[model samples]
Target: MASVSRVASRILVPFLVVLGALLWLVLGAVAWAMQPPTTEQLATYLDDASLAARAAEARSYGNHLMRPELLERARFKAENLSRQNQGLAPLDPEVYTPPAAWRGMPTTGTVKVLAVCIAFADKAPVTPVETIRSKLYGAGTGSGFPYESLSAYYERASYGKLHIEGEVLGWYTTSNARSAVTETTAGREELIEEALDHYDALGHDFSQYDNNGDGRIDYILVYWTGEHGAWASFWWGYQTSFWATSYSVDGKRLGDYSWQWELYSWPSGSYTPLVAIHETGHALGLPDYYDYDGNTGPDGGVGGLDMMDANKGDHNAFSKFVLDWLTPAVLSRGRRAVSLAPSGEQPEALILFPQADGQPFGEYFLVQNRWRVQNDTPLPTDGLTVWHVDAQTDGWDYLFDNSYAGHKLLRLMEADGLEEIEAGGGADAGDYYRAGSRFGPDTAPASSGYDGAASGVRIDDISLDTVATTIGFRAEAGPGGLPTAALGLLLDE
Candidate 1:
């Protein structure tokens, strides 16, 4: 991600509050519940020219949340890790190369921290290094090294931009590592327990600390492996720290001090910086945006390319929501070290686009009619309205734009929580916007179908037919990060 000028601390506290609340809601909920398209036309719609332009966005979102491997990597980072103190004492002259990017970023009102590794021995150790160095630290030809890729990841992720307030801990394996290594595998239970203990023991006191001493850590990236077998490799602190690079023992990861990058990779196999950064982004509360559809779209269809999608499809870039959510954490954590300009401000409004021709709940909502916004002072601008050219003043009529933010901004704008408004202004029109895309001006241009206005627009939540406009409609601008502006729906009202 590139450096942004947005500074949260300087903006109004409300901006932080709103942004924080939304991010917490979205990030905390990993159980994404997106409905798949069932109708052919709708699928075709997603494939239309406009949607196609967002291929980068799709890939970015997919990479952030969908890619299992990247998510797994993030899971690794989220896990707290520490080694059992063996007979050995903490390494002296602690090799600490600061995260170059974090050098000039914001900080939370806490102490800033950076993960430091000290598992490797001094260089040119052909002199038989023991205790920590072994045959396992070298790389194999073509197979790749462990730490190289990770180093690149740190550089790319921070790229001297985002701020993180935690320090990922890493140390060499103690005797406990030998004892636990029964057979070839360490067993999932053992590993899980160890990791839990590591985190539980270390705690987050330092995790959230920034240079300024704030108590909020948004992200901490760490990766290292302990001994797993009777005859395993020694942990390389520097020079691929914990990596088994027996392949070409590149002096790079072995605490060479010669290389200039701040963070070094800990693995022996080759690593890609992009993958590492992608994984780290997840730790900060982002989700995947792309998909490789094996069941639909087309054979070998990964929809399009994006970072969230595995390399099997596409990679790179970040999504709008990803950028929005992370921005707050970065600012709150004090990544923007400079004395920022001012104080608080918040996103004017949130949006909700629920009613659509297709329904996730079978046919129940497929043909209902209702467009709702809170009934604040702005009325249609704040309150709900029909879609398209409704019987209202705004040609977008049934469509709404609260003109400005409302008091009940999100008190109830979700599909399940939308309040009903009066439709068609009739006794039966009762209270509810005409849903199902029924009110669009162009919907029933000239004649009506035998049943009524046979328009592509269809009602979503409204029950009355006389007030219902059978036009196709899609909700826009939601607090959930769905693309509203791009989708032609006004959500902020």
Candidate 2:
């Protein structure tokens, strides 16, 4: 009896200790869940070492917002030349059009890019060549190391209509030091010339990069070894027309090129491709949607909602139309019901014109169905997004100077009647038009032009489903300003 009692005690003691520890762990987990850390408190625990490194990198670049004004001018000239070549009249200097041919990269079919990995004599590249390649052209989710490759992002954004194929070459050492190369614009230009010269000497053909056979390389991405300069500096990631107009290799001229840092280590050490995607939008001839002068207040533009804005999500519907990736169904002067599929999944949208013969290049409204899927996962909500665009207003002047009476060239028509987006707030769940929403002249922000002219366009009875959103449009004007009753009969047909 005594021996059996000793054995039972040994096993019971160990079991009880284990059970107590399990219970304690569960209680602790529950307590943590009940009082999670606030965002500010949670931020305190983040590794500041990485933040300091990024800051140091920015300091190295001398903190300049290298606005590409010269590049914009050059692209503007090239676009006018393209129009002339196509036997179309050149637009007025104030007018802007979607770029094509020499104006920007082609938006269709397979477009090849030439990526050069450059390193200064003193600063060696931290990211490997293969890693950079994966980030540019990897196949699957993990293939790009931290996120999807640049190619995958574009392929999905374009609905597979546009494909990016390219080769990444070299850890080519430059003859100059990092300080020398980053000293001036001319220094950076020399580095590019040197890098291309080395590749040309190696018998690599450059003619294939010009997808449109336009005697210029469609686009070139240069990965320099260092931390990225924040906005505009010697080391900042930017797209511009190469300054050396007289230089060429393999009988091809280098025109538009994007310069990027070799690695991105912020918040955590990882190679994210958001910056590259945003700069590439510029290379493709899309203007920045954010306020360039930092005057985003009381009438804010798209705040971190677009790739060309804060570099957050997929390109907006207006950008897609500019790229010729999607065709929007036009809504003229009549009452009609339309069903719009998810713009991210389908190449469809609605464009409402104020006039019967209103030109697309003028003032209009673009409506798209946005869903929180794919690259649009960062979107604040999923529903119908309405955009009021004034393309006649120079995007550069208004975006840079903030002199347009707080009016953005491209402004979001917030559905919640709050004008939060215009009141220095970002997109929220209420900004999207859900079921039962009505937008017309009676709404808080009437469907009117910047000049306060009634567009006479009304969107009503918005409804949503899993796959699409349906909306009704009622235009007050008919052909020759006929009565709505007369157009009602014609519209019914």
Ten residues in sequence with the least summed lDDT for candidate 2: 26-35
Worst 10 residues of 1 by lDDT: 328-337
Query: Best-fitting candidate, measured by TM-score?
Result: 2
Q: What is the C-alpha lDDT of each candidate?
A: 0.22, 0.60
lDDT of 2 by residue, 339-386 (tens): 666777778776666642433245677788887766776567778888
What lDDT, from 0 to 1, does candidate 2 have? 0.60
Pick the lDDT winner.
Answer: 2
Listed in order, each prediction's TM-score against the native is 0.27, 0.73
Residue 177 Cα positional deviation in candidate 2, in Å, after optimal superposition: 3.2
lDDT of 1: 0.22
